[model samples]
Target: MPGVKATALSAAILVSAARAEPLKVGGIDLDTPPSHCAPLRDAEVPKAATLGFVSGAMTASAVYWIHREQRRRRQPGKATHPREWAIWTRLDRKKKGYVTRKDLKSLCYRFESDEHAEHLAKQLDPWGMDHINFSSFINNFKVVQMMRQAGRLKLWHRCCGLGVAGNVAGHMAQAGEAGQESHSATKPAAIFSYYMPPHPYQVSDQQADKKRLQEFPVTYAVIDYPKLPGACKVQVEPELGLLVDIVYTKDRKRVDHLVPRRVAAFNDCSIRSLEGAEKLSMKKNWGFGSKGISLRSFPVDGFGPGTFVDFLALVSYMKRDGEVFQYSVKAPVRNYLLFHEPLLEWIVEQINGQKDTDKWEEIFPQLAASDFPTSSWIALGAGEYTDYGATHFLQPLDEVVVVVYDERVMPDGPGMAQVLEMFEDTPAPAGSVMLHQTFV
Candidate 1:
C-alpha cells in the first residue's frame, strides 16, 4: 500500500480520466488524427521502395554481366541493344521473355503455308529438311535461299527437312577457343539470278532496223581471280544489275551483252549520255543485295572499284572492237533469292556433334536433292559487286554437274583443293555438260 500509494494513486486517477478512444457518448466524437498512417506511413513506404530498387539493381547487374559476357564471346568490339538487354527480365515468367530459338521453331511449325509449301519442300532437301517441318524452321533467309535455287530446288524441291530441336547443349556450352573455323548464318535472304540469256545482238542489220532494236555491243576487258582455271581467263560479266547478260557464242569472234553495254569514250564526244556507251562502260556494281529491294549497277564491274577483281589477279584480254551490247535474262517470276550456304556444316560440338549426326540419319533417308542444293548468291545490280554483299536472287541458275561429291571423296588435301577449285568455274561437275549442241 505504501509503495503503491503516492504517485501511483495520482497516476491511476489521471489514467482513468484519460482512458478512451475516439468515442461518441451520444453522437459527438472526440479524437485527433496522426499526421501519418500508423500501419503504413509515407516515409516507410518510400524506404520500402528504395529497398526494392536496390534489389532490382543488383538483379539487373547480374543479368547485364551475363549478356555482356555473351556479346564479348560473339565478336570483339560488339555491343548489345536495349531490346536484347530486356531478355534478362523475361526470365521472370511474369515478365516478357523475348523469343528464343524454340519459340521461332514453334512459329515455324504453326505457320500454315499459303505460298511456300511446295517451294519449301523442293528446297528443304538441299539443307536436309522436311517440307512442313522445315517451314517452321525456315525464316526470312531460308525463303530467299529457296527462290534463288528454285532451278535446282525445282529438281528436288520436296526433299529438304531439318530436325534440329532444343537440346541442353545450349546451356552447357562454354565459350572460348582459339583458331576455330568460324561461320555465321544469315537469314530471310533476297533472291539472286545466276543465268541470264545472251542478248540478241546476232540479229541481222535488217532485223535490228525493223524492230528498232539497238545493238548490244560486247567489250572484252581482262580480269583475274583465283577462280579462273589458268593464270586468268576472260569471261562475260553478267549484268543482272543492268538487266542484261553477256553471252559468249561457241565461236569467240562474236560476243554480246545486254543493251546497256558500254562503248569506248569516243574523241570529240562529251562523255555524258551516249546511251549504250555510257551504260556499258562501268563495271563491278557494288550495291546489288541490300535485304530485298535496292539500287541497280551497270556491268557487275563498276559495282565498287577494286573489290572483286582484287580477289582476282591481272590477266590477258582480246578486245572485240566491232560492237558492244547486252543480253537480258528476265524470266518466269519476280526477282527471287538464290542461296548456297547449306553445304557448310553447322557444328555445335560440345556433345551434339555426335548426336546431331545420328539424328540426321532418321531425317536423312527421306532427304532428296532439294535438301542439299545451292540456293542463292551475291547477285549484283547495276554498279553492284559481290563482297560479303548479302544479295538475293530471284531465280537460281541451274547447273548440270557430272558428279556430286560422295563420302568416299573426302575433303583431304588435294581432294579438297580440287573441290575448292571447282568453285571458280562452278561448272557442272565432270560429265554433266550436254554434249549435243548447235552453235547459234
Candidate 2:
C-alpha cells in the first residue's frame, strides 16, 4: 500500500511538470509566437550518408513518440495534430537544413491529392530552385497563417529599398547615384517611411507620435506632385514592392523571420542631385508625398512558378503635355537579379549582416532602437529607365505612372500603342496594379 501511494505521488508530480512546461518541437517553444522564438543556432554540417541515416531514424522516432503522446492525451472527437516543424524535419531527409520540391510534394500528397500536391510544389518553388531553406519554409508557413487569421492589418512603418538590383546596364550612372555601383545588389540602399497610422495611445500622448513623425516623416502616399525644394531634379524609380511581416529576435538585435504577403507597384522617387547627401537615405526621404505605392496590391499565395506573383510584370509610363510615353523598360518581375525566394533570403542576410560603412547605414541597430516594428514594405529594386525617363526631370504637371500587371493577360508583351491606350483608359486596365502621381 505504501509502495502504491509512492507511485501515485510520483505520477502526480510528473503530470504537474508536464502541465507547467509548454509543448516544444525541434527545441522551439510552441506556446510562444513564432516571431518571439530565439534565432536558430548554427548546427554542425553532417556528412551526407550519416545525415540521411540519422535523420531518418530521428524522424521515425519523433513521429512514433508524437503519436503515442497524442493518443494518451486524446479527447473525444479531437483530430490528430502534427506540428509544422515536425513536417519540415521529416521532409528534410538529409538534414541538410533545406527541403527539395520532391519532399514537399510527397508530404503535400497526404492531405492534398497528387495533382494538387504537384501544383503546390510548383507554387512553393517559384524560382525553380527545387529546394528551399528553413527561412523560406517558415515564411510560407506564416503566409498561410496570415491568410487564415483575417481582419487585423499587420503594422509596418518603414520601407527598405534595394539599389543596383535593377541590373540594368548603366542605370546607376544615368541616375547619378554616386557610390551606388560599388554597393552590392543584395543589400538595401535606403530606408524611408511608408505608413505611420497614429496609435490609440498617441491621442493622449501627442509627443510620442511627434518625435517619431519628425524622424521618419511622411514619405509615402503621394496623391499630388511632390514639392521639390531649391534647384533639385526628381525622377521616378519604378520598382516592385513587397509587404512583409518582420520577426525579430527577443533581444531585437537580429531579424529572425520574414513573411512576404503582398506585391504592389512602387515608386522610389529620388532626387537627382546628391548636393549635401553623404548616404543613400539622405536623398530618399525628402518629405511628405516623396514616394508612392499602388493602392491596389495582389496577395502572394506563393513565390513559385504557378503562383500569382509568377505572372506579374512591371512597366512604367510618363504623360507630359498630353502625350504618353514609356518611362521605364517593360520587364517581368522575374527579370531582377535577385527575386522571389532568393530575394527574400538575401533581404534577411542584409538586414542582419549589413554594416554602416561609406554610403550605407546600419539597419538592424536602427530597427532595434525604434521599438522593433512588426512589418515593412520593401521596394525590391527599380527597373531600367527609358531615354525619356532618364533624361527628363519632372516639370510641373508631369504625370508618372508605374504598373505591375499579370503578363499572362498579354503574353507577348504589349506594344507602345497598347501601352498608350492603357494610359488613357479610365479606371486602369484589368489585371493591373497602378501607382500614378503627378508633380506640382
Candidate 3:
C-alpha cells in the first residue's frame, strides 16, 4: 500500500512540474518544464491538496524527483520526443537503431505517391545522409514539418569548408613532395568551398569578379555520381567530415565559436592534374557532384580522448572491374597530429585569420558576405593512401567507398571482402558511415 501511495505521489509531482504557472520551493521554479516536455503539459494534474495528508518525507521526495528529471532531460544524446522515437522504431524495421532514406521512402510509398514520397524523403533528410539516428530523426522531423507548413520545404543550405591537415602520416608526401618540404605539419590549411554562396558577389572590376567566381563552385552534392570534368584524371581523397555549428561575432567579421556536432566519412575528391590551377580549391571542386560525403554520421559527444570520437577509425576502398583494392591506410581519427579542442581552435583561427595568398584564397570575406551561415561541413583531412591508391586514377565507372566505422565493433577494421559485398547496398555495420560514389 505504501509503494502504491509513493507511485501516485510521484505521478502528481510530475504533473505539477508540467504546469504553466511556476511551482516554487525555496524560490526554485519546479513548474518550468524542460524543452523536451512540451507534450507533458497536456496531461491532467491531480490537485496536491486533495491528497489530504502531506509529510516532510514526501515533499523532499517530490523535490528530488523534479530536480533529477530536469538534469536527465538536459543530457546529450537523449531523444527529444516520444512520437519521434515511436516513428523511428517503426521505420527501422531491421532493428538497426537508425533509419535510412530508403526506409523512409519505402514507408512513405505505402501512403504517398512516388513523387511525393521522394520529396518527403529528401525533405526529411536535408543533409542527404545515408542513415538517420533517433536524435537526428527528431530534429529533421520537426524542421521539415515547420518548413512544409510554411511552404518552403526545399533544400536547406549552409556554408562549409575543408581542412588540409598535412600531418597525417605520409599524406603530405603523397599530396606532393614540395608541400611536404615547405608546409608546416602543425598548421592545417582551410579550403572553405564545401557549399558556396547561392548568389555571386558583385564586384567592380573584371579581376575581382573572376576572384569571386572562383569561389562559386557548388561542391557539396556527395550522394550523387561525380562527373569527370574534361579529360582530367580524378582521384578520391578520403577524409573525416565534421558537421559543426558556427557562431559569428556580432559585427559578423569573425567566427566566435565552432562547435562540432557530428562526424562522417567524406571524399574530397580531387583532380590529379593541376594544370592552370593557381589555388588548392581550384583542384577541389569542378561543379555539382564533384565532392562526396557519407549519408551516415555519428553524433560527436566531445573531441577529447576517451570520448565517442576515440572509438572510430577511417578506411577506404576502390571498386574497379568487379575487383576491390585498398585505397587508404586504415587510420584512427585520433591519430591526427592536431585533434580534440586543439583542432577546433586551429580551425577558428584559420577562419578568422586566413588571407588571400597565391596558394590559398581569402575565406572570412566569402563567409561574411554570405550572411555568415550558422552551420558548416568541414572535411578534416585525407588519410595516407596505399600504393594502389596513390598510383591509380579513377576511370569512368570506378566506385569509391570511404567508411568511418567504430573500431570497438570491428577491432581490425572492416574487411575488404565484406566492404565489396555491401558496396551497392546499405552499410551493414552499426555506427559506420560510408561514402560510396561512382565517377561518370
Candidate 4:
C-alpha cells in the first residue's frame, strides 16, 4: 500500500510538470495562441476580406495587373531592344551571376584602407578605452559618437551585420496580408528568425505579452535565403520552424517581365516629347525605371517574438526604369548607416554622374567596410532615401549582385538546407517552429 501511494504521487508530479505552460495574455496563450485560444493564425486568413472592399480591390487589381503583364510577355515575335537587353542582363547578373557572398565579404574587407582600419578601432574605444558598450551602439548616441571618434567603426559595422541579418530574416518569415490580417497571423515572408538560447531580439506577438511573466531574455537567430529564377517565397503561420513557414510562396514572383517604356518613349516617340512626362516616372525624379524589378526578402522583425525589439516590417518596392521587378524571396536588409547622409555623399563623389573607370579603384578607400549581412531585399539603385521609420539596418548593396542556389543538389534548395544544417550543426535543443527536425 505504501509503495503504491509513492508511485501514484510520482505519476501526479510528472503530469503536473507536463501541464506547466509558460503563461497567457488577454486570454491568449503565449506559446501558441491559435491552438490554446479559439483561432489559429493561418485559419483566420479568409477574414482578411475585412480589410475593406477598396483595399481588396487594390490588391486584386495589383495582382491582376501583375498577372496580365505576365501574360502579355508570353506573346511572342517581340524583338529585343537595347534597353530591354540591358535590363535582362542586370537581372541575370543578380540571379545567375558568379558573384558569391564571400566575394562581398572580401570586398568589404578590402575596401578598407589603412586609414579606414584606423578609424574602425578608434570608434570601438570610446571613453579613452575605459567604457564598453558605451558608444558601442547599445549605448546612447554620445557614447556611440565617442567610440567613433575613438575608432570603433568596425564594432558598429559588425553589429550592423548581425542586426541587419536578424531583422531581414524575421521579415522574410512573415507574410503580407493587408490590414485585416493581424500581426499575430501573417506577416511579410521576406525573412525568418530563431535562436539557439533565445536572446533579446527573439520576440513574437504570442510571447510579447508574457515577457513580464517569465522575465527571461528572448534570443533570436535570423536566417535569410535568396529566390531562384524559377521560385518565389511565401510566409506561413505554422506552430514553428523555418522552411515549413514558407509553405506556398517559394515561387510567387521572379524577375518579372517588364514593359519597354524607355524604348517606347525614345523610339516610338521622340526624346523631346518624353522629357516632360518622363520627368515624372524618371529615375531622377521617381527613382525607378532606370532598372528593372529586382526581387529580394528582408526580416522586418529582428527576432521571431518574445522581447522588446521594435517591430520591423519587411518592405518591397519597384524600379520600373531598371525594368527589373525584384522580390526579396526573403525581404531586403535596411540599416540606419546606409541612410546616413555621409554614405550618400560618399557615393555621389565616387560616381561623379558618370562611370570613371580610372577613378573606380581610387574611391575604394572611402567605401564603408562593413562585414555585411544577407541583404536579400531589392532596390533598383541607390542615391535615393526615405524614412520608413526603421532604425538599425543595412544597405549600400545597390550594386551587390546575387545568385541562385541550386535546387536539385538538396531539396528545399541550398539556402534552406544550409540554414537547417546550421541549426542542427549547433545541435540546439532549441524549440523549432515545426518539430520535424532529424539528426543525421
Q: Candidate 3, residues 165-186: lDDT per residue as tens digits?
A: 4647557568662355534465
Count of backbone clashes, every candidate in sequence:
97, 2, 2, 89
lDDT of each: 0.23, 0.62, 0.66, 0.24
Clashing pairs in 2: 126-304, 126-305
lDDT per residue for candidate 2 within 262-302, as digits (tens), equals 98888877777756666666666655555776656889867
| Number of clashes found in candidate 2 | 2
Instruction: Give lDDT tens digits, candidate 1, residues 1-440.
Output: 75766666566556546875343332333243445635667779999999999999999999999999997676311022211121112212222323233333332332322245445444434453332221232333346333333422242122111111111111001111101221121221111112111222344555534211111111111111112122111122221211212232344222222122211100000011122322111111111110111111113233223422112110010112211111112121011111111211221121112222321222111111112211112222111112211121111111111111111222211132343332222222321110100000
Whichever of 1 and 3 has more lDDT, that candidate is: 3
- TM-score, cand. 1: 0.17
Ranking by lDDT: 3, 2, 4, 1
* Per-residue alpha-carbon lDDT of candidate 4 for residues 1-440, written as tens digits (9 for 90 to 100): 97987777666656556889544444544456565456637856666655676697898899999999997785321032222222222212333323233322332243332344334344434344433231132223243223222332232122210001112223212222113332233212111111111123445676444321122111111111112132222111111110111111224221111111100000000011122231111111111111111121122222223311111112222122222222233222122223222322333333222232321222111112211111111121111112321211221111111222212222232244333332232221121111111100
TM-score of each: 0.17, 0.56, 0.61, 0.18
- Residue 169 displacement (Å), model 4: 29
Model 3, residue 190: distance off in Å is 4.5
